[model samples]
Target: MPHSPDDFAPYAHTSLPRLLTTAHLLSGAPGDHREPTELVRRTLVRVCARWRRIPRDDVDFYVRRFLVKEYLRGSRGRARRAKAQRAVLVLLHWEGLREAEIAQLLGWSAGAVRSRARRGLAVHGDDAEHLRGLFAKAATGLVPLDVQLDAVEQRGRALRRRRRGAVAAVCALLLVPGIVFGGNRFMTGGSTDGSGGGAADVAQSPTRIVAPGERVDAVPGAQVWLTTDGKHWSTPEAPNQFLGLTDASAEDTYRNKYQDKYKDGYGSGRKVSVESGKPTVSVQPDPLNNTSYFLSGLYRGLSADPARVEVTVDDHRITGTVLTLAGSPGWGVWYARAPLSPEELKASSVDGGPTVTVYDAAGKAVARGGAAE
Candidate 1:
């Protein structure tokens, strides 16, 4: 049995195998099980740690539902591997290992192993028959299981080599046009040299000017700042900057230095009001889990009064509620609570970074954040 949240807290790190086994049992297979288990475990830990703030009922539902959705989405790729698995099944059976032993070795339950074997036998009847004969011969001291396994491995390698060659041929074919176009451009010196010489160069040069205070062209959506002296640079700030508390203890030191530099209503005077009449929404994104989401903002807005606010991270709307806090004018901060699927977190936009967007109840844009390397 799985431990309760409190009992499991200390053992969270060590219970990974149990979590994996639970996920496998629930999903009927361990397909992509390792990653999902880790994600769920981390989400549970965070949720349990903040149990006082999160609604227990919602947390329970969210955890299970999120896992199911992610598992289903992940299984699409596994469907393609069914053919390869059929071949593996024949090879495994020919090694004289019983079905139970195969189940244990593969980390699958007995029922799943039996189901896979039956389905595999149906799909590869001839292969199974041939393999069975080979196994019988081996049992009678006529051949060896290791030799059969070796032959299977060799055939698999040959298939892979053929696939690789085909892919190379396709890539070469696609590169032909690009190669010709580049060659033509290089020979004609058409915009190839930085110095403009062609008739078109004069037309383009005037449009591109390097000027003082001009922003440099950076990767799209990147945040860059410039200082006049080129000595120290800071992160680009919005018109009304709200400095993040990197180290809460250092707040006083920063306030002392810059507090008097700006006007009386400069820093803390710009208030982000969470009106009682307006609904409050919060969002949080967990780096550990691939999930980023929002919560309670919509419901709060509806219950209190009709209002519009948009939350955004890097200009993308969060999909679900991850965290919520309570207080007047919403003195709480929400985070992306649902774990991100591994693939979602790993995926990058054309600019090669994660883009996040948040919107308020009125579908207006609020916050945007992104990371790139």
Candidate 2:
């Protein structure tokens, strides 16, 4: 299974623009050409040298990891203050990856990823549109692909010669804890499903929300806006816990332990199929009080375009707040709060216990999610 420059060229062409934008952002200077360009070039060289040995399925992710490390190793001054925050935001929004996916990439726990990401979001979440604009602008400034391709081949050969084909050391440097996303690579502006296409059509499911409750709306209803306001992240019931949600795909949502598998209408650690177009929900219990819960997740794949997210707990339904970046194709974060009596709380599972549903603008139920035996 040997690979040559010709074999690797196509991938490099498709990935270079994104790799350049990531480098520019991580450098804390989206408009600057010096740091980001060099970072991408060097990382590309490393990938090119190991092209034959690196698994084909992971080439994109491997490139991203190398870019992050190279950035961290070289970061300094003002750029260091919010490095984690910036990195987390980039991966979540720009890359469309879930918290767990990012955790794997960064060698951190999912909880750690959430905590730092909340902090970062508190600072720049409201400016999502502006940030995206910056990324798009940066993509235009990348070094010419042909010039970089030449550099990659030449530098890759030199690196291989110096190391004498010792890939073990290189592999060790690249090793980081997390689940491998088999046959997936970094894709910009589309779904990362293995089908090599856009997001799948939303499918119907048995999941349902209680009727005759407050209708879902687009206005922000959460206690605190993680993307805007900087305060109110913590409640008396759950000190310092972020009460906002980030967008996660159906797969990422169900994979979480708290929401995985259902038994007798509850998430009970059994396998379940989370169909496309059906919304996926995760609940975070308030640590100090057993009465309140925070619900959040994604609704991007529905057959009908999603207009709102509705949550039903103990027959009480509430309109969930939605966060969508400008220019995005109807995909963003949906969150709601459920305060239940201790008895009611104890009766439900922590993560997938509530009934969450998504509706189109015409108020049709486009997709459904939550525990159902």
Candidate 3:
């Protein structure tokens, strides 16, 4: 049988006060209170539509739980709603709602609600006490009740305004450094290679060398490639050398060339050690060719310069002149030759093998040659 209007009227009227009170408590202040009320009204309307299925005992529980869950989930705006909900919870606690009932009303576990309530009380209880004290003092004086209430409301509004201003100031302070750093990077055209070009371009270009101990910015769109010769190379065009590419044979050739160059000691088995802080080096080992090559380095800050790197192996020191060219940052392709003599290899503690070092744009060492031991 269809329910008559009178049959639903009592439930609707009785539910109104509960919903309004809940909304008001959640709303924080007059300026923020209306929205919570509207939200509560809508939620209740939806719950009521399903009233037939909900047991009479559970209807209030369900509606209250829904409001609490919505507030916790922060469906509206977290920052604003969270503050309002905290204010509301404070009022509810003061009204003598037990921790368990508050939990049910807020759609949180009872323990969680109790913990949060305790913390909230610790933070706001003093203010509430002060307000109550002010009201009590006013009540005992000649001021009218309405006038006392008005003064309390004004004080609360002022406090909230001051708190909001402090929060805004803190947010600005935290964001200023990020804004400056980002703006400087953006204005300088994104690459800090010291040459004012993209970091990837500087890395890939045969002509470009990252100076030692200099910072270079990363290129947002740069692609890096590796050759078995211990050189970090970059290219705008996709080099056929990447994994699963069509130029597998070309990559094999490049790998073979490095292996052959290092097969017998070429530069008295000399090895170069490179490291860096700003640009990071990536390598891929070609199992078939027994070689690994440079992939890419993301450059940043003073670590962008390549010339600051030091390269040395055994007794053969990498003179500063050679270091200047060989350690230039960005990407470099280096070849490590086998020991010139067994004695030379033994002296360097290498087993007839070679080593390579990669340096960042800032001349800070970033990577070392593959372990041969």
Top candidate, metric TM-score: 2
Tally clashing residue pairs in candidate 2.
1
Better of 1 and 3 by TM-score: 3
Q: What is the C-alpha RMSD of each candidate to the true structure, in Å?
A: 23.3, 20.4, 23.7
Structural similarity to truth (TM-score) of each candidate: 0.19, 0.42, 0.30
lDDT (Cα, tens digit) per residue for candidate 2, span 1-373:
3355577779888887777767776777755677787888888888887777654544665677777767666567766546866788788867878885576566455677788777776666567677666666656655643336877888887997778746776675555321254223322233211123322222212222311111222212222222211112233433323222232332333435333222323443222234454443433333224555555544454444465566766656766766543344434456656676546754665544666667665445656666542
Ten contiguous residues minimizing lDDT sum, candidate 1? 224-233
What lDDT would each prediction earn against the true structure? Answer: 0.34, 0.54, 0.39
Candidate 3 lDDT over residue span 1-373, tens digit each: 2233233346655665555554545554434545665566555544444444444434555566555555545555667545544744543553446664554344334456656655655665646565445333432322111112233334434555676799999999988986976675555553323245434322322233433211111132222222212222322332223221122243334445455443443223222222333333222222212222222211222333344222234544221111112433344433222223434433444432333344444434555433241
Best candidate, lDDT: 2
Candidate 1 segments exceeding 4 Å error? 1-318, 322-324, 328-331, 337-344, 349-352
Which runs of model 3 end up more than 4 angstroms from their true locations? 1-7, 31-33, 73-95, 105-107, 126-373
Task: Give lDDT tens digits, candidate 1, residues 4-57.
Answer: 435334443344443344344333333444554544544443434433333332
- Please identify model 2 stretches exceeding 4 Å from their true place: 1-5, 76-81, 125-147, 165-373
Global CA lDDT of candidate 2, please? Answer: 0.54
Clash counts for all predictions: 32, 1, 46
